[model samples]
Target: MRVKLIESRKVYDGEVSMRLERFSINGRTVDKEIVEHRPSVGIIAVEDDRIFLVSQYRRAADRALLEIPAGKIEEGETPVAAAKREMDEEIGYSGTLKPFLKWYLAPGYDTELMHLFVAKNLHRIPSRREMDDDEDIAVKKVRLDAAVKKCFSGEITDAKTIAAILAYRLKPI
Candidate 1:
């Protein structure tokens, strides 16, 4: 399916107000407006039975929360590349990252599409995030089961984290 622009509306000339997704289905043209958004990447960093995670202060959550490594994809970056870069930057690890799952983080208001991945065959190195800007992350290594429990306990409420964990379980080793 490809978007064939039929008509466009300028909501705000200052910034990208919205994009009308125009496409054809069964010889009929359809249009759906979507907010312009950036793609994101997530990782379930795993080693043996343990999964690497991070604990950080989520301003929206009002406290420090546990979650798998994730971040937004920068301009002109692919999801697969973003996954590898995030794994290396956030957790100080690098290895084969298999594409796990892809979904919309929240479709109601935001157009954030997340690409979840499993970073297997990890190599532990010194953390590169020694002194980062506006980020204070505490690295944690938890058993996969424990991570799942924390997710259920609401200690980890991020959708990407939950999706990554579930994908890890369903995927073939």
Candidate 2:
């Protein structure tokens, strides 16, 4: 796809940013808005037969969600490093990370590329990284098979978590 930019303006700048733009594509022109987000990583931390999950309230969604440990890739950080960091901070454990999948969260109007990894051989740490001030995460554990079932039964609704669970089921690391 080819798009010629006519104008671009930043509309919001917080943890996530948004931009409004005008672009023309192949003789057609239109205005568009996009979310500018740093790349992020989600870790499917599986130890034994269980998968680690985190339950936290999402202010934007106004409800608690069950999800895998995840966070934005910081500046100058690789996806694998971000995955390890998120696992440590959120789950208080670290594991061997194997990249599983990568996809755009919303390509139509977003620049967020999500990297998913399956973490194995987990071991607890004496002290984990501190959580972000805005985050209040509760760790949860469920049978790996049951988690995959939840994905198909609507219990696991978070997109990244669902994708990671299914991907691990299909092609485990």
lDDT winner: 2
**Candidate 2 lDDT by residue in tens digits, 1-173:** 78799999999999889999999998798998899999999988888889999999998889888999999999999999999899989999988999888999889999999998889999998898989987999999999899988888888889888888887888887
Worst 10-residue lDDT window for candidate 2 reads: 164-173
Q: Taking the tens digit of each residue's C-alpha lDDT, what string does model 1 give over 37-112?
A: 6788988888889998988788887888778888878888898888877777778888788887789987965578
Per candidate, the number of residue pairs that clash is 0, 0
For model 2, what is the alpha-carbon lDDT of residue 46?
A: 88
Clash-forming residue pairs, model 1? none
In order of appearance, the predictions have TM-scores of 0.76, 0.93
Model 1, residue 14: C-alpha shift (Å): 10
Worst 10 residues of 1 by lDDT: 8-17
